[model samples]
Each structure stands twice: as structure tokens, then as C-alpha cells.
Target: MKQKRRVRVMVAKPGLDGHDRGARIIARAYRDAGFEVVYTGLHQTPEEIVEAAIQEDVDMIGLSSLAGAHKYLFLAVVELLREKAADDIVVCGGGIIPDDDIKRLKESGVKEVFTPGTPLDDIVKWVKHNITPRQD
Candidate 1:
């Protein structure tokens, strides 16, 4: 118990990624960890993700894409975050992304990316480490 703040999270599945078993599990893990999680259902676009994040003022955005469109979808999401001036929100993703794409995703402003087999504890740890109380 590190005296956590209210961590709001939005778990989304973008593109044509029809595989959401992992996403659902992650959302449940976050909820069990005492986070306020807003789960965006399948096939969400970048605009929708950003809109939800801003409207909800979430601390983190989690994307689960397995449709091999992660590269395009992720870039769009990052660009939208910048466009809406929501770059302060922490972003991470999990799915069937390749090793090379992970580096590129990080370069494109995604703070972190988790592939299949990543433990829920690792995801929770990343959020806890990255999100902080607003000092402003």
C-alpha cells in the first residue's frame, strides 16, 4: 500500500482486433487493483479513445490490438493525443505486436507496450510508477 491516488484507466480495443479476451482480463485486473476503469468496447478509433480519455480524465490509456494494424492505429492515437493536448496522459498497449513494433511504438510516444504473456502485476506496476498526483 503505497498510498495510491485515484487511478482512472480506459482499456480499449482498436482497429479490427476481434480478440479481447486479454483486454477483458486486464480491465478486471485494474478494477481489482482499485482503479476506476472505463472499458471501451471493440473497434474503437483514435478519436474515440482520446475523447473518452479527456472526458473521463483518466490517468492511463490501455490499448489492446491484435489485428496487425497496431502500427497505424497507435500512431493515430498518439497524434490525436498531441492534437488534443492530452499528451500528459500515460499510454501503453498489449497484444500480438512484434518485437520491432514495440520499439517503434515507444519512439512514437507510447510510454510502454506489453505483449502477450505480460503479467497483470507488471501493468499495474507501470501505472503506479508513471501516474502521480497533480501538483498543478
Candidate 2:
């Protein structure tokens, strides 16, 4: 039997948002689910997060924002990825996001926005179903 290649995911905190307990928890969940997780620590700019995503060569970029700047911050990262010709990278996010904004977020390129209380297993399953890992 062939072993499946592991998926690589980058969990990032963008903008001035300093509350990272949720980010940390999700990162751990992803790690525990057998993904190769790269976490960009707190207080990262959109540039920093995208740059790290490229450098890390991640399959997906997961943004965590709780400071009410999800619109700007999430879109910024998505835009940068497009600008850099890295649009193939999947992007997802989680935090205190409003239900009303979820549609706009998906339309703008975020594949998923997992709000607080979302099951960790659901996220794991989503990634497994959605992304086809890049071959090195």
C-alpha cells in the first residue's frame, strides 16, 4: 500500500490581533490530525503572512482574526496571493466572524471561515476533502 503524502498547512495570525488562544488551539488540532503545520506567530502583517506562506510552500493558509478586521486582513492576504501568482494556495480562516460576512468571504477567495465553536474534526475533514497536496 502506498502511504499518502501529508498535507501542509500554515496557520497565521494577521493584523494587530493579539488574542491567539484560538489560533493555537486550531494549529494543534491540525497538527494532531497528521498535517504538516507551520504557524506564523501573532501580530503578522498581510505581507508577512503571504511571504511566509510562499516560503513555507504551504498547501493551505489559515488566518485567525478576532479583532474585527477580518474583512481587511483576510482580503489582503488573498489579494497578495493573487498578486504573487500563488493563487493555487487554499486559504481558510476562523475566529469571531459574523455569519453575514461568510458569503462575502467565500466569494473573495477564502475557502472556509470556521467560526468559534466549530468542531476541530470538521476542519480536519474539510481540509482532507478540499485540498490536493502539492507534489514536491
Cα lDDT tens digits, model 2, 37-131, are: 99889999999999999998899999999999999999999999999999999999898999878889999999999998888899889998998
Q: Mind giving the per-residue lDDT tens digits that candidate 1 earns over 1-136?
A: 7754678889999888788899999999999988889999998988999999999998778999988999899889889999988888878888899999999999999889998888889888877788764444
| Pairs in steric clash, model 2 | none
Error of 1 at 74 (Å): 1.1
Candidate 2 deviant stretches above 4 angstroms: 1-4
Q: TM-score: which candidate is best?
A: 2
Q: Which candidate achieves the best lDDT against the true structure?
A: 2
Clash list (residue pairs), candidate 1: none
Q: What is residue 66's positional error in candidate 2, in angstroms? A: 0.8
**What clash count goes with each model?**
0, 0
Task: Write down the TM-score of every candidate.
Answer: 0.92, 0.94
**Poorest 10 consecutive residues of model 2 by lDDT?**
127-136
